[model samples]
Target chain A: MMAVTVITIVLQRNLFSVVVLAGIYSFLMATVLLALDAVDVAMTEASVGAGISTVLLLGALHLCGGEEAKPLHRPWLPLGVALVIVGALVYGTFALPEFSDPLAPFRTHVIPRYLEQALAETGVPNVVTAVLASYRGYDTLGEVVVVFTAGIGVIALLRRVPRREEER
Target chain B: MKRQMVLRVVGKLFIPYMLLFALYVQFHGDFGPGGGFQAGVIAAAAIILYALIFGLPAARRLAPDPIVEAMVALGVLLFAGVGVAGIVLGGNYLDYFVLDGDPVAGQHRGIFWVEAGVGITVTGVMLKIFYMFAGRGRSLDER
Candidate 1:
């Protein structure tokens, strides 16, 4: 279902529809998360990915050309690079720990301690919150910076109205 | 504007509560799976919903340019200021012990203030970007 929407996003020419398609994509991603028994992740994905990101992307679309982005040039270099990445990812999937493996090495690592003491340390019931706020606070801080930078970058890129051309 | 009474009334009823819930999410991130980013977006969305229903001009009026600009600097400053406090208290960056007389309490305090900072900046950017979008000559209202 989502694949159709995403492919439509890529293939369609209407920029507004593209934003709508991205919004649908987020909803689908949230559903996928719920199917995997990751309730908290699904919730966060729905709230953040669907709600905020869709708004931002739509707003950006409005500020710029509200038209489907046209490719600059059909270059095979980027296509080849993307193909290589997809190939590598497919190859790597074979080595992945079987889904729901109780004895997976990843399940028995430092996460156990973090999970055990997460509430005591941060007073948060949702382990994801504890890890994000306390255990990996630095990364969250970095994430904030990244968002800030993206806003700045977007404004800088779009505010180019050729200085010499006076306004009405 | 569509004179559909339901959307107009529902938007009026829902916006205030949505803003309140956003604040709650921002402060209660420690106890839940939400934080500054989510809260800011929710708050921005509420305002956006208002714009979508009431009018874009009204929304832009509610949040002006200067407010958005100040918020950007304030968020980054607040985040860095907490780290400075930690440095002054003989610890590494963002140590949070220096925020208050007590270190543990200070960590909580530090996290709260920093997250609030993040929320402010995010909300500001969202509103500002929306304003820019709505201000464009895409619609008939803007001359």
Candidate 2:
């Protein structure tokens, strides 16, 4: 289903349809993540990817118009770059541990401690939340700061600046 | 918007549930699959839906510019403040151990506050971005 959506998005010229297809793709991706037992990630993907992005893109489309413009140049060079990146990613995946492998390096290192001690340590049943909020909090802080920075940047760039006479 | 009776009615029915779900996601993160980030976006979506149905001016009146702007900064500060609180309490920065007498309780408190901060920031930013994009069309027309 996701592949079909992607194909449709790529072939379709209507930007509006592409945006709707992208939302469908995100829902499929969320389902895949849920199947992998990453419920938290799946939820995030569904909301951020399928929900908020669709709205934001539609707003942008309203501003810029809904028709996909014709490209002036051939797409061969970009296609080559994309294929090379895909190859590299596929090659890198080969080195990854098998699905849910208990003895994977990451699983062996901190997973044991987090699983065994998270309840005692944080009293949180959700190990993902415990890890995200308590165990690796600094990273979450950094993420929040990043979000804050992005918000500031967007407001500065997009909000109407005061007219010069008003400033004076 | 006034002419779209179906949309307005449906939006009114759905907005409350959306807002309620966002809060549920926010507070239930400790035991569930959601957290501040998801909750924030959900809450913002409620307001965005209102904007879509009733028009942007109404939504802006509901959320207000100053409060949304303040939320963006306040969430970041709340997260950092919790870190500083740890330092002040004689633990390392970002340490939840010293947040309360019982380390586990402290951990709970710390995570709750941090998640709240994250939710606030996320909700603010999402709304701000939406407003900017949606309002651009009107501003252009006015100019």
Candidate 3:
């Protein structure tokens, strides 16, 4: 389902349909995350990727028109780069431990400690929350700052400046 | 402007529930599959839905840009303030153990405020991006 959505998005010439398809793809990806028991990640993907991005893209379509322009130059170089990157990533994945292996490095790491001590230390029942907001507070703080920066960037780019009398 | 009675009615019925759910996700994050980031996005999504139905001007009226921008800054301050509080209390940066006399209570207090800060900032960023995109090309005169 996700692959089909991506293919359709690539083939479609209408920007509006592409945006809608992208939203569908995000939703499918979110469902996949849910299947993996990553409910928190699924929620974020559904909201930010599907909900917010769809609206933003639609708004952009309203300004730029709905039809996509044909490319003036060949995309061979970029396509080759993309394929090479995908190959490298796939090769790298081969070295990963089997899914959910009990003896995996990750499983042998601090996770057990986190699971046992999070409630006592952070007083939060949800370990993810404890880790995100308490144990790894600085990382989350940085993420918030990044979001803030993106907002500032968008405002700077799109906000209209008032006309002065002499300029008008 | 011709307003769709059905959409307006349904939207009116739905918007409150959406807002309520966002709040639930925000405060109930500690106990469930949610946190400040998810809650903030959900809250911003509610406003975006409102904008879709009632129009941008109305949404802007409900959450003015200045207030939204302030929320962005204030959330960071709240997060940093909690950390700074730890420092002032003779603990390391973001050391929630020293937030209160009871170390566990201090962690609770620190996480709560930090999460609140994240929620506020996320909400502000989402709405700000929406406003910027939606406002482009469509002048107020058109409305």
Candidate 4:
């Protein structure tokens, strides 16, 4: 369904319709997250990745003069990369343990204890919160830094100074 | 222009609650399905609604450009500063428990504040992006 939406957007001439389709693709990906039992992530994906990000892209289209009639340059390259990646993932999935398997290597690891012990030990009820804020907090800090850098990228892009040589 | 539309009136009613609810989500994240990221997005949504209805300039007036940019930088710096303090206290980088005599209690305290920083920065950055996309002038906000 997501692939259909993306392809529809790519093929469509109307920029607004393409943005709407992109939003739909994001909504579908959020559903996939929910199906995979990552509800918190799904919630974030729905709100941030789908809702705000799509709106941002749409707003950009307004400025960029949307919808070129030209064909995509090197479309087959992307298609080739995507197929190889999908094949790799499909093969890798077969080796993975089924969900909720008690004897799986995942359950035997510290992750299970992290979820089980977070509330009793850290007083943080949400295990994701505990893991993100505690055990692997340094990485979370780095993630925040990445977000900060994105903000800087926008600022630097917006704040372009004209060249002295171009001045009359 | 008889100033009335669903977008305008509903947006007026919803924006404040959205922000308040976002704050609640940020603080209560230790116990619930939400956290700084969720809260930040919710808050940004509220402002975006305001921008969509009233206009980008009014939203920018509510939150100026430089202030927003500073928040984006300062928030991460504040969060990292906490971790750096922990590092200076002779623990691994971002080791929060080292901030107190009891590692567990210190971890909770540090995380709460750090998440707040994340929420603040994210809110500013999201709003800034919205403003940037809508453009710099103040045409659409007053209505």
* lDDT minimum window of 10 residues, candidate 1 chain B: B134-143
Residue-level lDDT tens digits of model 2 in A1-168: 777888899899999999999999999999999999999999999999999899999989888988988999999999999999999999999999998888899989989999999999999999999999999999999999999999999898976543332341
DockQ for candidate 3, please give it. 0.69
Candidate 1 residue-wise lDDT, B112-133, digit = tens: 8778878987887777666656
Q: Model 1 Cα displacement at A8 (Å)?
A: 3.7
- TM-score, model 3 to reference: 0.95
Clashing pairs in 4: B54-B140, B54-B141, B55-B140, B55-B141
Colliding residue pairs in candidate 2: none
User: Which residue pairs collide, candidate 3?
Assistant: none
Which scores greater on lDDT, model 2 or model 4?
2
Worst 10 residues of 3 chain A by lDDT: A159-168
* Tens-digit lDDT track of model 4 for B17-136: 988999898998888767888888888888887877886667889888888888898879888888898889998777777888887787888889788888878987888778766762
Best-to-worst order by TM-score is 2, 3, 4, 1
Highest DockQ, which number? 2
- Model 4 lDDT at residue B16: 88
lDDT of each: 0.75, 0.93, 0.90, 0.80
True contacts kept of each: 0.29, 0.84, 0.84, 0.56
- Chain B TM-score (model 2 vs. true structure): 0.97
Q: What is the interface RMSD of each candidate, in Å?
A: 3.4, 2.0, 2.4, 3.6
Interface DockQ of each model: 0.41, 0.72, 0.69, 0.48
- Candidate 3 chain B has its poorest 10 consecutive residues by lDDT at B134-143
Residue-pair clashes per prediction, in order, are 0, 0, 0, 4
